[model samples]
Target: MTQYPHSPENPMCQHQPVCPSAEATDREAARIIACFPEQGWSLLCNGVIVFEDTGELLPDGSSIAPHRGPARHALAA
Candidate 1:
């Protein structure tokens, strides 16, 4: 449990990396984007990739599909 005096609502997250570090996260993200399921990816007009699920822009121009959903629909224009 957090012992600092920070607010409980925004308590400092104590979870540390168990396996996937930032580099691993990037690699995994790239792999997912490269072979994303049909619903997870959007090809922008300029050829950039945008993720559909959480709207977090993929670092390498695509996104890592969220884990639980069926996948996202095509990105909105």
Candidate 2:
């Protein structure tokens, strides 16, 4: 079995209020431990890697596809 980087008992967050867990829906809110804008990716404290396009790779090696919100259209007068 593959070993995940983060777990409930070993959450890697060190922030004051504590960031969300890797299993949480809001896991992307975790603090960024490392970032590489040139590579278009960032590593979060909860052991997740997020990309510039909003795609994600969870600690367990599962992937979350890019989830950008719909673009806003200007209101017609």
Candidate 3:
């Protein structure tokens, strides 16, 4: 498995406000911190914040992008 940098050594959040998720990872936590206004919505850790959420960044970010599928036709032949 790909070892992410932000994987917590201990099963606890190392930030001011404790994180409830035990499954949280290092990169994942950093991404979430980036969204914090006080934190300037960006954690420039070992990984780069290519995006505020998802894509080049980690899988799950602050807000998830909606699915983009083909539009359905109202008038059927």
Clashes of each: 0, 0, 4
Q: Estimate, for each residue in 1-77, the C-alpha lDDT of model 2 and write its tens digit.
A: 54444445437865657788888888888899999999999999989999999999988999999998875653332
List the candidates' TM-scores in order: 0.22, 0.76, 0.21
Best by lDDT, which number? 2
The sequence of per-residue lDDT tens digits that candidate 1 reaches over residues 1-75 is 644443232222122222222224332322121436577755322223445554544335554545554534644
Better of 1 and 2 by lDDT: 2
Candidate 3, 11: how far from true, in Å?
11
Cα error, residue 42 of model 1, in Å, equals 0.9
The candidate with the higher lDDT, 1 or 3, is 3
Candidate 2 backbone overlaps, count: 0
The models' CA-based lDDT, in order, is: 0.37, 0.83, 0.37
Candidate 3 structure lDDT: 0.37
Q: Which ten residues in a row have the lowest lDDT in candidate 2?
A: 1-10
Model 3 is weakest, by summed lDDT over 10 consecutive residues, at 4-13
Task: Tell me the spans in candidate 2 whose CA falls farther than 4 Å from its real position.
Answer: 1-10, 71-77
Candidate 2 collision pairs: none
lDDT of 1 at 2: 45
Mind giving the per-residue lDDT tens digits that candidate 3 earns over 1-77? 54433325323235434333422444444324444445333433323343433423322354334334544663442
Off by over 4 Å in 3: 1-31, 36-41, 44-53, 58-77
